[model samples]
Target: MQQNLNYVYPQVFWVDGCTSASASSPSAPPVTPFPPPVPDRRTKPGHNRERRSVGFLVIFMLILLALTGVGLSMFQIFHLEKELAELREVRSAWPEQSMEKEARKAAHLTGNPTQRDLPLEWEPISGHAFTDGIQYHEQGLVVNETGLYFVYSNVLFRGSICSSQMLTHIVYKKNPTLPGSHVLMEDKGINYCTGQKTWARKSYLGALFKLRKMDSLHVNVSKIALVNFEESKTFFGLFKL
Candidate 1:
């Protein structure tokens, strides 16, 4: 074959058999020249198709990223709205809860002896005796709310003649849940007096208990006749914890 001396510039050939060159002669084949010669991508149909596929893939990835970002933003907005709704609910209920707590704090009463029944009755309003949320019923103090409470009682005993019998003072709760009163606290006096002479004794009992609404508390002694019905010496009282 005859040599085609039309080739003027240095020819560049890639591994794929594509060529690249630049010529000063106008008759030279049109070729774009660049350093570090690579495949002549413009001349090959398969190369052109590959470049188009890569461009489309890049565009698809960009669209997918944008959609993902929008979805995340929407999710964050929904979460914030839910938290705000919960905070509003709590804020709306706060005042009522505070009022109830104040009411519970005021549920306290003290009573002095008024009657000599088996379950001693009391005068809740006379002398130092006072009643708030608690009420004095038939023969006991009635609970108006359910909570822990401090129950307390004091009793004084005096007689002209000393007796060998035991002295007992008890504070108990009467509830519908049980058939009988449940003793919450008790005190017993033994050998309190030695001679057959006039003497006086005092018994006090106090404790913490879990009380329920509608429950009643009463004081009991072994002998009602021996009790001194003084307001300062004999009284029952309770306050919420």
Candidate 2:
């Protein structure tokens, strides 16, 4: 039985057979293997990097939007202040030939007080007239009443350039009913003229259509507060006005 153990190679080609059988067949077709699976093309490392960059750009844009809002608010506030000043200047000059009348009024108002019917309290001066306390100063004359207030000035005959030049303290209000001369600013708005020359200043208030008075009793003011701290609300002069 072992006499024919050797295998004879086949002359015809064989298909889909074991390796050993295929080896014995000289005409066996070569086997083809599937290529390694193609790597996932859509989820590459570079693609993930681009997605992260886009997310960061979106966050940066949101931060820039918030900063822009704050800058706009500051700009608006500054413009409003400038416009208000110009309006006051126009309003002050509403009287006839301003310079001549104011000079005459200032001369007569020295050492005199202007009298008003309004109760001694803080109130608007645009349309209202104060008949009470009228005092003169180097800067101008002032009409004061009871209670703390920040009254608006129309225009000064002599406006100061420096803050110190305009600095002044406000004396508290005095009762007209009291017997003694209402203290001419004994407590506040005092400026020493020891080193400098005392400048004479004046103020006048009246309308073009109305007749103005020239009664003298208003004290000439030396304190320059009406011009100083002009930009501040100035409701109180260290007395919580």
What does the lDDT read for residue 217 in candidate 1? 92
Which tens-of-lDDT digit does each residue in 1-241 have in candidate 2?
5587786765543444422235567566655644567887687888899999998888888777767776777787788888898988887876754653443321111111132322112221322222233443222334332333232222122333322343222232233344433322322222422334333232322211111222111222344333222212211111102
Per-residue CA lDDT of candidate 1, range 1-241, in tens? 9987894565545634545443445465755544566765565888889999999999999999999999999999999999999999999999999887777633323334456478876777767777778888877888888999898888899988987999999998898776888899999998988896898999999888889988999888998888988777788888887
Q: What is the lDDT of residue 166 in candidate 2?
A: 37
In model 1, where do residues sit more than 4 Å from their true spots? 1-101, 105-114
TM-score of each: 0.56, 0.25
Best by TM-score: 1
lDDT of 1: 0.81
Q: Deviation in angstroms for 143 in model 1?
A: 1.0
Q: CA shift at 25, candidate 2, in angstroms?
A: 2.4
Model 2: what TM-score?
0.25
